[model samples]
Target: MTATTPTPTPTPTSPSAPHHQPLLRPMDLAGLRLPNRVVMAPLTRARAARDGLVPTPMHADYYGRRASAGLIITEATWVSRQAIGFADVPGIYSAEQVTAWRRVTDTVHALGGRIVMQLWHTGAASHPDHLGGRVPAGPSPVNPRTRSFTTTGFQETVTPRAMTPAEIAATVADYRAAAHNARQAGFDGVEIAALGTFLIAQFLNPRLNHRTDAYGGDRTRRRRLLLEIVDAVAEPWDGRCVGVRLGPYLAAGDLFRPDAATLADHDELVTALNDHPVAYLHLRGPDRPTPDARPDTAALARYRHRFHGPLNANNGFDRETANAAIEAGTADAVSFATHFIANPDLVTRFALSRDLATGDPTTYYGGGARGYVDHPVSTWQDNPGQQP
Candidate 1:
């Protein structure tokens, strides 16, 4: 069925009542049973072992602390060395990387939490600094004019070499191998990172993908890479255990502007996903909407009728709005990024209606234990009569 297929009725709760939060309800995401609908959105902390691109012991501690989340999507992980865009981010292609991620999954599973690894390829968003001075590969030779987070710091993006048919085939293999590694690492599932201007997204965008090959032409050809990756990933794990993230309205840094054609392409893409056994469609809302604006919610609703599977709304979601989205049936679940960073026990905090701790921006990326795992949990004293 497509993402627009009607889902089972969610638990009935008053959206206005804080004690009756709908986000705390259980959900059956494809085949994975989630305790609550509050999913922890993936956040890149850049804390992996720089040399081997392996996850560290700190990753276990970090993810383990946020085990209360119904589902935790680990930070964007490189599928291969060619997928490298940001410095210090973990990769799943190596044996050591798989072993390291196993520790993280074990920690989260031990705490009774479900977790998924987000597979990523930065494409033109990458810098030569991260790729051993070699230019990155993309759908076309177009330069996104974006910046990449390098070891030295942020570096300007350079024009990427257009991927050949053989190279594209190899990249697809890389994603399949990565999914297999994630399974070996004991993750509950894997999320294909197609959001923003990432590699898969770069191929999906007509503007960035200027190729005259079969992978270019119409919207169907443009989305061929993403579909191929999905089919390949299913070889390692069932589509029921796989999720796809898409950013139809991602206009960050003026890179991926959502024009009529682009938006229509996304609509077709979402509809086409129904043919696959995808567990859920994770849709990112508009970029940087105003605090009071429910544009994210509106954006999700716009596509709610297009997709038939379970829909996970992301970007700038909070406790109340999340509950409202669930109540309104615009989203099956909501994923939180920043709120989850500072409040590891975010599920519990929402249960108790406790104030959340703000994360330290300075130590957000490429940091030690400070901003990574040092966020404190709320005490029982902070919420009297609330059992957490």
Candidate 2:
């Protein structure tokens, strides 16, 4: 997530015109120099091995093809079985998972693309069937508004049992180990999935957390878990290798944070991270039919004063909009979620101002490489191998 003020300034479509480089060119976030500003936002593709949550060789091929972007953050990786909210999502807790992910990271690097794993825990959204018959955990028992994917079938999210103090400490440890496994998997870094409806976000949301402990109540205490996780992940790892993603305003995942509290935590977290050494802050506003979900950067005008680090703002950003954001200095870079799903060589296509392939929603998730790895880069018809 990028450091933002209340108002996010838009960048020029082409800061350096004539040559027609990408709307946002390659940039250095902390110490990571990306070839372009369009980050491959982590999308859930449940292709991991059925039993152990291990990544397969196909995962390597899948990510290696899209190495043209500034960075590729892999899909949500569950920190523990209790965190297994999504079917077939990868994991970093087991040695087998680490080994399998190593292939993915090596493949991406061999192809000249850097990758990061998005560490995640589903909290109350997790299903009992998915976690050794255990009930899901959250601030309270508030279930997700929508159905969550389970191993057996889609189930209604249940009110989860509140966790004990020891449980919270254990989760923090889970994050630490996941970070360690991420390093062992040879990843460039890890992104904290504090965004959306993950466990950490649940602990921070007052509407959901309704707890009386230090982890609940006010916005400042609510954010304690996320901040600690960030700091925990950064403890033994390089500061530049840790990134965090969250949606301050729009409710994605299972969380719908209040507008004012969203703004407050945004400032607090950024300020707290000012002294720490994290790579980037990945901020997502609402996307799709609704644009402009990013929080009021103007409210956080002081975040710039406190945190002077890399910011990657994500939403429904196109080439033109992304460049505008960069030029305005609202964000150091922009992230593309759907755009990259269809355009394998999105950077080149954007640089040349070529036509982009429309992404197939059906193939976005639950499918094999059919829609995952086979998307065309340029003219769909030009690539003989892309035909479904």
Candidate 3:
């Protein structure tokens, strides 16, 4: 007379392959040992307290549930008040925020999990309302021609004030301070958010950066700000525990179209990172398939050849394909975003070949524990033999 939930049919794996997948292999990430190659990528679920921008017990429980991942990259956290753009996003600039994050880290470590904080600055992606009635700062005074998530709702982005030389240096110092605070918060490392045409990427892309100074104009100059920020962050944690995310292929369709020039600049960016040598190069490509319906394998190969360190490849990778990439030596680790959202036991599901629960898109952001931590673990009743 006990009530029960129906179990979905188990998916089949290759007959010749072992029940254990290549994705389950233990690997090294910037000298830190990982139990598996599966990484939980940073996803922005705005559940933090709005006033102080601090994490709570809910955040601790959310991350603790997914402790089985080899590594967990936390959502983008503002390095300073100037970096905030969206409401309810977390920050690490103050002592209160750092202390709050420590609880989350302590919870994860209690379960023997590794985690890293992703430092972020939204730049032109922010609106004045979110910045205490001050225009956002960026590499150039250009509008991203996009909308941003604000307190009221989605609002159009305004033209951010171009950063002066002094302001640029201040921003780098902010990154340094954030790195120091991250260490205090007990994070395993820090990842710089340099993708999606955000603060750092704004300087990388020519379309967004139209400055006529050392921080812009050409490829080398455009990369100056990002490299400087890297140097600042490395001072606190060293290069071994640092990683940078790059999405050169990402651009505004209506405002800025990508051309051969953009591709060449991205190549230069990879080469520069190779010379500096961070923990890993987080390379992202088109989120979905192209017109040909094929993942950009050529782009992935090109990036792998350029970056000498461990390469963390992201963007819509499934269990089968991700395993294939690892087996083929194309990627050292694979980070899951959406999959991790719905299934806290994503690594187990992949290893056991169990059906994954569907994630609720409606409650993806600005919500409580409904879709954040309420997803049930797979019952796996039909395939009891496939337990990991």
Q: Largest lDDT belongs to which candidate? A: 1
Which residue pairs clash within candidate 3?
A: none
Candidate 2, residues 1-388, lDDT tens digits: the string is 8986664333443343413344446677656788777789988888888878888888988899888778999888988766788788888999899889989898899899888889999988777778777788887878756567867667877778898878898899999899999988898888998867768877877778887788887877888888788888887586568988867666655357447766677777777776766788887754454564544444323454456777777777777767666766777777787888788888776665566788888777675778888876676455444312
Model 1 TM-score, 2 decimals: 0.94
Error of 1 at 385 (Å): 9.2
Model 3 spans > 4 angstroms off: 1-20, 290-294, 382-388
lDDT of each: 0.88, 0.76, 0.85
lDDT of candidate 3? 0.85
Worst 10 residues of 2 by lDDT: 9-18
Tens-place lDDT digits, model 3, residues 197-240? 57887888788899989999999999998888887888888666
Worst 10 residues of 3 by lDDT: 9-18
RMSD of each: 7.3, 7.9, 4.9
Q: If the candidates were sorted by their lDDT against the true structure, best first, what order would they fall in? A: 1, 3, 2
Instruction: Report the error of model 3 at residue 353, Å.
Output: 0.4
Return whichever of 1 and 2 wins on lDDT.
1
